[model samples]
Each structure stands twice: as structure tokens, then as C-alpha cells.
Target: MWLSNSSCEEVVVSAWGSGSEIGVEGDILRKVEKRVKELGQWEKDVFGNVKSELSRLRKEIAKEERIAMGDKNTRYFHSCATKRFRKNSMEGIRDEGGVWRTSQEDIGEVMVNYYKSLYTSTDRRVSTGILDFVSTLIDEEMNESLCREFEASEVASALQQMAPLEEPSPDGMPPLFYQHFWSTVNNDVTSPILSWLNSEGLNGLIKKAELQGEIHGYSLCRRGPKLTHLLFADDSFIFCKATMEECDNVLEILKKYEEASGQKMNRSKTSLFFSKAIPEEVKHEIKAALGVPEILHYEKYLGLPSLLGRGKKESFDYIKEKVWRKLQGWEAKLLSQVGREVLIKAVIQAIPTYTMRCFKLLASLCNEIEALIKRFWWGQRGDRRKVHWVKWEEMTKSKTIGGMGFQDLAMFNDSLLAKQAWRLLNNKTSLFYKVFKARFFPNSSLLEAADSRMGSYAWKSILRGRDIIQRGAIWRVGSGEKINIWQQLWLPRKHPTIPLICPLESFENHTVDSLIDPSTRTWNEQLVDGLFVEEDAMLIKKIPFSRNVAEDTLYWPYSTSGNYTCKFGYRFFKEEEELQLNAQTPPICHKHVWKEVWQMQAPPKIKKIFFGEHARMYFQQNMH
Candidate 1:
């Protein structure tokens, strides 16, 4: 049955029988309209039923669409897709003669010629001066092996390394097809890829330029690594001295790269970012020389600022605006309480997560975001004010602890930023860490790093995150040589970092390594028992030592993997806050029973309703 749900029609068409017969929909709808118009009660009932059915159908359709998109953030995905389309759609191209080619045929010709010039190489001989600088690291035997003809076994081995479902070539055959039908297509595949079929790619050209000293790169600090360029997939960021000579050299590198790689440079899309030290006249000359746009202040790279200036809150305000826009959508108003919760957690909270991972947002901004979410949660739309039944702080608690399990944005933000600090602590070998270490705190480790008074905003944000790490991180006992028993948090237990009883005057200066027996890589049980109180002794004795005598390592005890994660970090702070609050206030009666009520396996709305009813009944009976 072909049922059309077109809004323009008075009534939709539907088939009654299983075959091609049409239903008597016209007569039925006429009768329904007549009955609906005749009696006021009947009219009301019929209109209400129709409205309900229509709403249900719309909801079902929306649900199916969401499922088909394969993303819970369907609105977010749609927004991105729309933005990408607007940005990527090419209206026209300017030819070499400076005339716009708007027609498809003209544009096609321009593209073909542009790429043809890039791929087609001139028969110019290479200069011996440039080639002389190249070092031959390969031996004669290794060179011969590399230049040898390919074998079927070698071809099959290479094919096996590729993912089976990887995107196919122009032939529309994926890796899986070749692997599965190897017996049938082996001959056709192995013969074409000769060793002589070779060309220098963009990377090779860049490396040669670097080796010949034709290009220079800047360093984060005097002793840091000189970063010439950074390439993430298709996006590229090139660094060089702000001079006419360096700019010319960079342009020349790009010119050679285009010829070798069959890729045309999009000058209109390219931009040059200059430091404030560079003169305005020099900036103009450089922009004109490169034939690219000039970014006066900053531009976004992968949705984040490529360069951050003094106003951090202004730079990151887009995240807040994005959340507001998402909440303002009509779908948000239609969503149920459960739906709103999912949207807030999965989409709205995640909007800032990527930004938070790199920078610590202002406390004011976090509170504003929380206010927007809270307003939506309490059914306050536009100018209409609604009474908030529960406080946001109470709602931020876990569901099992008599709250809605909503994320506390400020805490979550700190946790996400702490992840960056965690990375810095664990991955000291990474280029990011090396650069930051050289610039901010070359003399100290991340744990001991003091705030740099004249550091970048990013450095300052990371230090804020380091505070959270400082609070929650405890050392895992290994060889324990570097850990001090008094200053550091080495104990495995939650509450206390040190022994319950104060350390003895002589023991305060000792390392954890002093407590371990040298002969058997185990804790000196007798010494531990004698030195501390019973409680401290039991906790210290329970901590197992590594058999191989590894170095003492810091770990977050809240997580199973001993690594600091955003979830565990936020929870740790929340628990600490709760502990402090509990200590200040009197204890509640039958707290465990109330906790059970919150933890019940029912819909949140139903549970809230049941609790309200139960509370009312209890108060009424007590009053009687």
C-alpha cells in the first residue's frame, strides 16, 4: 500500500487490500469530518486523537532517522554537514588570465590544466651541487636488494599487510577482493608494480629542502627541536623565520612540491599568520609574494584556535554559543526528560570536551553553560520561568546517591584538562611534552613544575589541571627509591596519604625503599609493624612490591588501570567535596534506606513521583 503523507493533501491515500486496490479513504474521511463537526464533545475527542497520532508518527519518524544516521548527536552531525557543504562548495575558479570560470566545462578545463602542470615534469638535469649533500646510508648489498625485481610472494605479503576493507582504487575492487580471489587475479596484480615505477612525493621534497638548508624552522625555546612543518592528513602548518628570504624559500618549496606530487596549491584557501614583531609593511609584502590571504589575528585549525591571544574567554566563547544553539532547537523542546538527559550528557557536555582537553575554560563560562542546561531541564523555555524542583548541585550527584547523575561542568572541565597534564607526566618523550618542557619548566618534572609567570595561556591552563593531579595522584610502589615516606602520597588507601599516627622523628627523612628488605624484594614486615600504628602498619604491609625492582611511579587510585581519566578524576573531587560537606552537617536518619529508593530500577520520573507520594503520606500520618 502506497500511503502518501503529504501535507498539501486534505487526506492521505491508503490501500485497503494487499493488491493494487485503493482504499475507500475519501468516503471514510468525509464521514469522520461530518461526525467531528456535528457534536462539540465528539469534535474535541476526534481532534485530540488525531493530534496524538500525528505526534506519535512524527516521533517514530525522527527516531528512525536518528538510527539511520548512526549517531546520537544527530543535530550536531547535521550542523557540521551543513557547514562543510557551505565551505567546500566551489562556485568558480580563476584561470591564469584572472577571469572566473563559473561554467562546469570551463572549471573542468582549468582543473585539468592545473593538475597536468603539477604532475608533468620538465626534462631538466639535476644540479650536482644539490645532489652532493645527500648521504648514502644504504650499502651496496642493501641497494641491490631494494632495486631487485618484485616476486609473487613479496606482492602477496604486502597485500596481506593492508586492511581487507580499505577503500578501493579506481577499479572499484577493495583489498578484500584481491585477497579472497588471489588464485584468480595473482598474475594481473604482480606484474605492473615494477621498481622503476617511482616518483618523489611531497615529503621527499621537503626532506631534501631541509637537508640542503634551503628552509629554516623555528624552535619553541633555544634548546627545543626546530619544527619546520607539521602535517596532519591534508592540513599543513609550515614554520620559518619572518624574513623575505625565508618566505621566498617557503614558496619555492611549495612550488617544487606541487610539481612532484600532482597537487595544486589553493592560494585563496591558504593563509599566512604572522607574529606581532613582524612589521605591517613586511606582512603585506609577504602576503603579496606568496599570493595568499593574511590572518591578522588568529584562525581556527580543526575547529580550535591555531594561535591563542590574551583574551581566552573570548576565544572559547564559541563552545558556549554552540551549546545554546543546540538547546534552542525545536527537537529539544519535544524531547522527554530521559531524552533531555541523554542529549545534555552525550551532545551538550561533549561540545566543550575537545576544547577542555587542551584549555581550562573560565569558571564563569562553565557556570553559564550549567545555567542554560539547568533551565532546559526544568522546562524553562524562552521568557517563561519554571520553578526548579531540585538544586543543580544535588542533580550533579550520582543516581545511586539520590541525584540525577548530571555532569558538573566545572569539575568535568578540570578533569579533561587534567588528562593533558596526565599525558605530559606519562609521555615525556612526545614532541608536545618536549616543547612545553623546554619553554615552561626545563629544570623540573611536571609534578614539581612551578607556575611560569610569563608563560603562554595554554601553559597556565595546564598548570591549573596539574593542581587536580596533585590532589588525586598517589605513587604505586615499585623499587620506591625516589619516593619519600613523609612528603609524597605513596599509600594505596583512599583517605590518608601518610600513616595515621605521625611518623617518628628519625623515620621522617627515610624513603619507602628503606622499609624494603634488600635480600628479598619484599617489604620488611617486622620493621613496618614496629614503626607505625596498627592501622598504618596493616595498610603499608598490604601494598605489594614489584618483583623486578622497578622505579616508583605515580598513579590515580580511583581508576582500575591506575591512569587518570576524566570520569575518575571528577568522581574523586566530588567524593572529597561530599566528605567535607558531611563533616560539617548532621547525619541523616536511615540514609541507607533513602539511598536504596534512589537506586531503584525504574524510570527517573516514576521514581521521583513515588518518592513525592511516599514523603507526603509519611508527613500526613505524623501530623495526625
Candidate 2:
């Protein structure tokens, strides 16, 4: 059913449009979709036999998409498309007397009245039975744990785990703000939350999950000194056991917090995720007590899925869709290859990396994403791939050796996850590391940790990139205390340095410090020279050390500054896999410079005028 090139153009080009004014952009997209749909099998079948015809259609789509991206209309369009707004006119509703109400005002009043009833108490009688049960729920043991005062370290631990991009509270402060100013405003921020947690409630406070927690099981993850509520500026989450007693206590605490903070609760967005194993009857009781829907898992935290099981495809399918939706904009087709490359690199691939870094993407998922990108890059529609002139692997190389410097998604994802591993390895004192330690690997270091049946997707993903991160980790010798001379990356070679993988007894306590001369805090040349051949000894000798203030540290060789970066990690993997360069360094040739001029965002007449003037000058100079 493939239509002729001419036919494809007629269908596509007619609906192409512009302008960010309300309704205009959507109209264009809607028209494009409708007209394209009308072509039906022909639409799928239609591709221009002539390269020019197809190219024009590709250009048209790109033109529309590029405009949308630049103008910030894409977000608006997406919101319009996804958000289901209530009809402005009234839908018929039955009044209390049984008469039908259809007026807009009547409908509005009815909706308001219905919502008001949810939070309102019709009968004001105090339930002695409920109160009596709540009082009995907490005994000497639970009260001792729950009543303890929260220390600054405990609050600091919570603040450290807050991701920067987490939604801003009603105070208009995002987690990023508190994170940056935590040092300066630590007391200001934590004081309110600490005060709230310490405040006595109507009944027993948090005893359990009741509230789940963060990575690096540190001061933050401790269920007790039992935390009842944690407030992020104006935003807060109440944590308590799934009992009527704890739920009632939380309600009183929240009421007090609202009075203090001046922020109302958004009940619509709030939900309860309980243990999946909880009985249905129990779940309903808890849900009723909290007045929030109960489910096994809820994913509204910081815009990331709070997954407890192994990372699955469905967990990341949203990520893929997010990536594709960004790519699917018609305005994208108008961009020059350079512009498209920038968009793909900066926008298309970027949307998912944050999530990808925190979790291992399925290989099939990775392939699907890569395929989607490849199609976009080549200006292909449906199955009609427009000559992918270069292999995709080559395209991922750095601009220095000369691929387009596109990040390979799989490698990039690994690199991002490796960063988390780096944090776990280097920053053990951080709450994240401590939490991860207690939950995932209490007995072993991050590298030594093994996967378990109950391990979370995040922990598993971090482990996946542990080896890659270790390979790039160059131990900067200081005290030489943390660096493992044999186990960790101590050598600066292209390959891993395994210094005689033998018995621990052979290496005198298996510490890097054992090899360091205590007096100079430098490598013990005698000990080093004796332990290895010429090549290994020389590498050990080149390992630098500072006696006074510099602590022994591990850093990446790929980065110039020794700091681990996502870009550097990506580049390292790309070079290792493909030694091929798709383009030459710098001016591979000025031959095609003029040919590229056509893609410039300028009028054709302007380009001609500039080139003509330059040519005349060149001719005059030559004649002279």
C-alpha cells in the first residue's frame, strides 16, 4: 500500500503548521494525525521513491518540531494532549430532593459540596472506643522508642538523601534548595521537622512501615528514635503503623503542622502503599483510617518509582515512552543534522538518564531506545529507514576522534549507575552508603555484595556498574588506608592491575598502607621492588603520595581533574568498544563547508550575497 513519493508529500505537507498560540499548534498536530490516518495502509505504504520528495517531507516534519522545541510550545502541547479537563458545561447531577441539576453553577456547587463532605465530620461525638484502642496500641517499649528526641544528625541524614529535582513544596522551595543551603540553614530547615516529630500526638506515633526509607541505611533510615512525620519545608509525609491508633495520631500531628506551616494538605495526590501481603480486610481498615487509597506500591515519590522488587521492563517502559514522546514532536524534523544532534544529545537521551542511572535498563529496552533514536537521526518514518549512512556504534564516539559525540544510551546508563556506585564506595560516612550497607550488604562492601531474591532494582543496578567504576578508579595514595593494594584499582594501567592475587597472609594484613613507607607516606620502594617484576614495580613507583593533609583517595583517570563524570565514563566505554572514528579531527576537509552552508538558519539570498562578495574579493586578490 506504499503510496508514491508525490502522494506522501500531498498528505503530509498540507497539514504542516506553526505558531505557539493556544489551539493553533494542537490544531496542526491534530490535522497531521488525522490526514496521515486517512491515508491508512497507504500512509504506512507511502514513501517517496525519489529521495527529494521524502527529504522534503522529512524537512517539513522537522520544521514543525524544531519550532515547537525552540518556542517552548512542546510542553504546552503535551500538557494539553495528556491532561483531561472537565467540560466547562454542566453534566446532569441529581440534587438532594431528586430533581436534576444541569446548570454549570449547580454542577460546580455539587462538586464542591461532594468534596467538602470527604474531609468533614458530620457528627462531632468523640469515640471513646477508638481512643481507648489507640491508647492500648502503644506500650512501654514502643513509647520509649517513639518519644526519643531527634538529633541534628538524624535530620541531616534525611536532608542528604533528598534528590535535588524533587517537587517544590507550597513554600516554593525544592529539595535542591534545602540541599544547597542545608549547611547555612540546617537549623532553620530541620528545626520544624524535628519539632513536629517530637510533638506529642493523640496516640502512639510511628512504630513501623507504616514508613519505608532511603538508601545508605544511616541515621535517616532508622525507624526509631521512632519518626512519626518528616516535613520538607511546607511539604510533609506522615509515617505510622497501619493501625487506627497510629493513623489517628498522624492526623492530629498533620493538623498542628498545617497551623504552624500554613500549607494545606493535597489529599488528591496523597496515597498509601502498604505491604502487598497484608490481608484485604486489614488494608481496607488502614485505608479508611488514613483516608488515602491503599495499594501494594505507590510511585509518586520524587517522580521516581519506589520499587522494592527486581528491576523489570514495565518499571522502565514509562522511561522509554518519555524518551519517544520527546522525539515524536514533528518540529524536530526541521532541524539541521547539527541541530538535531544537539537536540538528541541534550533533550532526547537526557530525559531518561536520571532514572536509568538509578536503575539498570533492560537490554531490550535499551535496544528499543537506540532504535528509536537511530530512526530519528536518519529521518526515517515507521519501517522506512532512510539510509543510516554510518553504523550507530561509530556515531557514539567522541568528537575529538570524530563521531558525532552522541552518547550510546546503554553505555551512558552504565556510566550514570557507576556514579552511584562511586558514591557508595567513596562516601561511606554519607547516609546513603550507610543505609545501602544495612539493607543490601551488611556483611560485605558494595563490590563484595551479592544479589538477593529480595534486592531492589536500584541496589542491583548499582552493583551492575560496580566493575566499570572500579576499573576507572585510580587510588590516589595519601594515608593509603582505604585503598586496597591488591583488590582495588591501585595501578594506572589501561588494564586492571592484579598484584599477585594470593593469600592475604602473603601481603601483611592486605592493606595498601602495608606497602607504603610509614616515615615518608610514600610507596616502600624496597617492599614494592621485591614484590613485583620491572613493569609492575615501575607502575607502583609512579603512584604519587602526599604526607601532610591529603587523605588517600580513589579517582577516575578518564577525567582530567580525577573527578568522576557521566560524560567521561561514557567516553571511556565508547573508546574501549570501537576504535573507529566516523569523522576526522577538526577540519577533516573544508571541501564540504559550502555544502553545509545551506543548512544554516539564514535566508538563501543572504548566504548567496555573502559568498558572492567573498568570491569577488578572492578574484581581485588573485588578479593583483
Candidate 3:
């Protein structure tokens, strides 16, 4: 058989099974459903009933697939079967010694021990003068929060943030358990935690952020899992279709939730976000129904810019405002050069990290950002200016390379995007990765995934990182059964410019091992030559076939070291950025050197007149 019933992915999927073919094609399934349409279908045959059950399951899966794939009813049988192997639930992890701990306490201890090793005590003594200065830096609000009393509403909100089915702690209880026993055990639970946090346990909250309120899901009032609103601390997200029904559902849920809990949704502050674009006429209709105006996109979500334009000019403009806002603040004027460097690195750059993790930021956007930082670095406060001694590029280089170790933003952006790619590859158990697998890529490997205009911008950004990921990915070939000769990236130490040995047509949907002599565990020369071009045919002889193992895995190209880090991607991008940026433009760093001289402990008159190194000449060169 060209395709096997054992699994759907074993066959190459050309297209999805058409809608018309549903409940009819795929032979064995057709016979079962045909009998069910007739009378007394279950009583007809023992084998036929099983097929009928499968037919119903297939129909359900088909409908869900269509919904998830944006109403596109396309997926091969093997592809559907392959998706079944994904683990949607926690399966617990093995210890470093390689033994799976089934008990919850054992697992908890393993996790605790693992994390404990990552921490080190900062036990150095500091002078009273330095300690007093640092203590002065702590905002008054922070101290007030430490001693703040826990309210009933606050505790409830905290409970609401936790996942209902989360793993039980060492105490054998999840948030769900506390929520159920709240009335009877309210004081017992609340008093100790409140006392601890107020007294000496403030750092515990930061260390264990796992303390969430309640998991968002369908309310008991709703039968289906129709989550309309989600609350995390103060922020609220209201989801609905651009119709009266959406408004009706949301309002009804809010009314009920308000009566039960003291908290209520702020109608005035509430905003609606549509997953799809809506017509202006329909927008007015939704507004009339919901009493909230429809918006194109929020200015920011969770401190990150959400739904910004894909273009460099539009997308990067927000970052400029963010950088300027930080520099314009009162703190900026008070800080020294070293203090400004820390603020720029720790605060300004950190602002865009969450957004950058999922985006391949434009080169010019990075440049605009660095330009603002460059101005700040040189003591440019508003229109007031200072001299710059070095190029931004030189300062952005590693500390060992005559620079301040300020990160090159362009390379940092690539590293962030590559981290997303790395997550898709390594974290298959993650919900996002699983959903992605179920929808767009049911039948293909990451390297073989086809581009789609229908894909979301975030997905497209992740796709952009695929090239970097592919460059670093090498396959650990075992049985060689899952390995595809033409489609997958398997070879180590091979350039990407090198084409596949055999044409897609020549291979005709065969595994890599098909070209090998199974007995000898070597390439079959005749089979290889007939399919591959002459040069590629010779190269095939050099490729090794593993005889000792049959399990296949994707290995990192940095080595078979088998670990995850964005450092490899960062290094590659750094090298590429150095070549491109250095070749294209002059250094922008030296423009601010004269300003730094003025900052020195020198006479005001001398500082004003002394122009550092070719200042007038440099300005003249840049003017035209």
C-alpha cells in the first residue's frame, strides 16, 4: 500500500480530503456509515458497528479541524492520526538521574532541587553609606505594599488567577481546593499567608509566582467552555463576535459574576477587540449593542505593543516613544553616565523584549532605537547636547573588544525571534505549539512547512526565524524510517545553498533508508545514482547510516551537545550584523565626545569653548 493505516503521516499528503468526501470516502469507513443510514445499523454487523463509531469520530474531528483551520476542511488521514500522539496534559518529568517520579511530592522535590541549584547567595557586607543610598531608592509605595492588609476581594481575585487543575503542592491542595473550602477555612488560610507576606515573606511572592487566582474557563452557568472575559489583576479582556449575540452573552455573564463577587466590569473602560476586521456599518451595530466602541488595536497589551503594523515605519515608531519617555523622565536628568548606561540596558531595552521575542524587528527600527540610546549615552538631554567619543557600533561590541558591551539591537532582535523558533522545536508539549501542529502543519516537518498568506503576523514572524533554525538543526538518524531525503534537514556540516541530492519527482515519496542496503547498512549505489544527480550521487556515499539505534531526533548543529540557548543564533546574527552595518555607514559615536568633556570637573568657560577632535569638520561632513 502507498499509504498505511498505522499512521496518517507515513504517507505524503498532497491535499486535504474534500468536504463532499466526508462520510463517503476512505472505503472501510464508508461501508459502516452506509449501514447506519439504513435501519438498525448497530445490529447489522459486529465489524460494521465499529466502523460506524469511527465514522462519527471522524466527522467530529473534521468539523473541529475546519473551525481551527479557518473553515478550510483539509487534512490527510495520516496527518490526523499523527496529531493524536501529542500530550495535552502534564506527564511529569524524570530526574537528572533518569528515573520518572510518579508521586506528586517526588516530582515537586525534583523541581525544587533543580531550581535551588540555579540560585546563589549574595552574602557580601555593604557600608552603611551605600546601604542608606540604596534604601533611599526604594519607592514609598513599595514599602506600603509590603505592609498592606489582604482584603476578601483581593484574596478571591488571587484565587481566581490559579489554574483549577494545577498540580497539588507539598500540602496536597490546589487553588481549587481552597476555593471550595473558602467559607469554612477562610481565616485559617488567609491569616497566615497575609501575616507572612506583611512580616518577612515578601520575597516569597516574587520567587513563587505560581500563586495564581483561578484558571479562566467556562462558568458553571454556561454548559460549554465559552470564556467571554478574563481578569488578571486589573487588566480585562472581553472577547465576542461582532454581533448582538456576543454582547448579550458578555452582559449576561458579567451581571451574574458581579452579583456573586463584589467586583464588577467597568463598562466605561471596557473595549472590544475583533479577531477579524469588521465593516464600519457593522462596527456601529456592534457598538449600539455592546455600548463599547470597536477598536482596530490596543495601544499596548501587557506592556507590549499589540497589533502594530508589520512595516518598519509603523511598527518601530512606538519603540521610539518608549525610549524617549524613559530618557525624558526626571530620573534621566539625575543619573550619571554609568547610571544612564544601566538604565538604558536594564530599563529601556527591556521594554521591547516581550514584543521582540515574537517579531523579526526591522533593521531600521533597531537603528532608530539605537539612535535614541546613542543620543542619551552622549548626555543629550532634550535639545541640550554633549560630545560622543566612540561609535555606537564600537560601544555595542563586547567589553573585551574596546566597547561597553551594550548589546547590538539588530542581533538581539534576531536572537529573540530565534528563541520563538527554538520553542516550537523543543517545547512540543506547549499549548501554542500543539495548536500550531494541529492546524497549519499537520502533515509536514518544520523545514517542510509551506508558507501561507492566511497565516497571522505573529506566525509569519516565527516563520522568518525558520531559516536560522534550519541552519542550526541536524537530525539524529536512527531507523531512518521517519527521515525524508528531499524534504527534511538531516545532514550535518552541509551548506544550505546545496540542493537536495534527488529531485522531488525522482524520489517519488520514499524514506531516506529506502536508498540504503538494509543488510549492509550502506547506500545502494545503483538506487542512489538513478535518483540523484552525479555530484549529489557521489556525496550520498559519504553520508552515514546509523546501525546501533533506530530512534530519530533533531540535534543542534552547534554540536550533538543537545541543549537549548539563543547564544548560537546571537553569535551568527552578530557576525552578519557587523558585516552589513560596518560596510554601509560611518560611526555615529564620535559626535558626542565634546559633550563628555564638558561633563568633567573643569572650568565652565574652558568646557564651553574646547571642541573635541574635528568637531566642526565632522559636522560639516555630515551636513551635506
Please write out the lDDT profile of model 3 over residues 335-401, one tens digit for every residue: 7655776688888888777778877677788888888888887777667777666667667764432
What's the C-alpha lDDT at position 305 in model 1? 80
Measured with C-alpha atoms, the lDDT of residue 562 in candidate 2 is 60
**Which candidate do you rate higher for TM-score, 1 or 3?**
1
- Evaluate model 2: give its lDDT: 0.63
Candidate 3's clash total is 21
lDDT of each: 0.72, 0.63, 0.59
Worst 10 residues of 2 by lDDT: 209-218
Ranking by TM-score: 1, 2, 3
On TM-score, the stronger of 1 and 2 is 1
Question: Regarding lDDT, does 1 or 2 come out ahead?
Answer: 1
Name model 2 segments beyond 4 Å from true.
Answer: 1-235, 296-300, 308-311, 331-333, 479-484, 492-510, 517-523, 542-551, 579-624
Cα error, residue 520 of model 3, in Å, equals: 7.0
